[model samples]
Target: MSLLLERHGQCLCGAVQLDCRLDNSDVSACHCQTCRRWGGGPLLAVECAQPPVIGGGDALGIHASSDWAERGFCIHCGTHLFYRLKAEPHYAIPVGLLEGEDWSLASEVFIEEKPAWYCFANQTRQLTGAELFAEHGQPDDA
Candidate 1:
């Protein structure tokens, strides 16, 4: 996607809407425990350089899952919104939320934590938990 391309999306209930520019068309999957528990599987998302413009502020909820990161969701519909790094302006938004956009899997993180019951057919770079922390900086506890 071009840097100038903007996308719009909303939660299941349409109580919250997002407007943001696409930093790339490549999507990444996170199989970390937190992500899996949050969404029932891996989180397939695209990183946005800037936080999306959030509509219906009152319908948005944020949970600080770790000292260095937080998860956002729609309060009304409980739709996972994004995973945000506390020290940065970036956001990893769920690809499913960006309706009508085609995103290709580029990578997968926390590969070691992924369950064996399911797997992706995509051939993408995979990173273990240790590698993810090393590359992105560990959470406070790490």
Candidate 2:
């Protein structure tokens, strides 16, 4: 199936909760410079089929990370929440924020920006930024 049934996750301080309809169980790693600067490393995130149902008081903070994408986080605890596309109904939530064991790193994007200091042993389908951006202006798959 293209979409997993449902998944639940929360911020580090439990100030924010999310009910997400995941597009798939597989996770993707973004090695782009923006991702690196945002998270200090590759962002291991899962794609959501639609906008997550977020429940939080005033602890949620959103930043326009780029012209086409935005990043959400917990203001109280500084937990990385989701990286979302502004032009589409797409959300990529950090795998660690969610509770699940079936998640696996399926692909890596912006391979050219990946640092040489670290590496993953798992064999994953990888694409450089140019290749990814050339795929109809988006990644071929989430």
Compared to the true structure, candidate 2 yields what TM-score? Answer: 0.90
Using all chains and alpha carbons, the TM-scores for the candidates as numbered come to 0.91, 0.90
Q: How accurate is candidate 1 locally (lDDT)?
A: 0.87
Candidate whose TM-score is highest: 1
lDDT of 2 at 68: 74
Off-target runs (Cα >4 Å) in candidate 2 are 1-3, 136-142
Alpha-carbon runs more than 4 Å astray in model 1: 139-141
Which pairs of residues collide in candidate 2?
Answer: none
Worst 10 residues of 1 by lDDT: 133-142
lDDT of 1 by residue, 1-142 (tens): 4455578888999999998787668899999999999998999998876789999999999999988889999999999998998876879999898865567899999999899999999999999988877777775245
> Which run of 10 residues does model 2 get worst, by summed lDDT?
133-142
Q: What is the lDDT of residue 43 in candidate 1?
A: 96
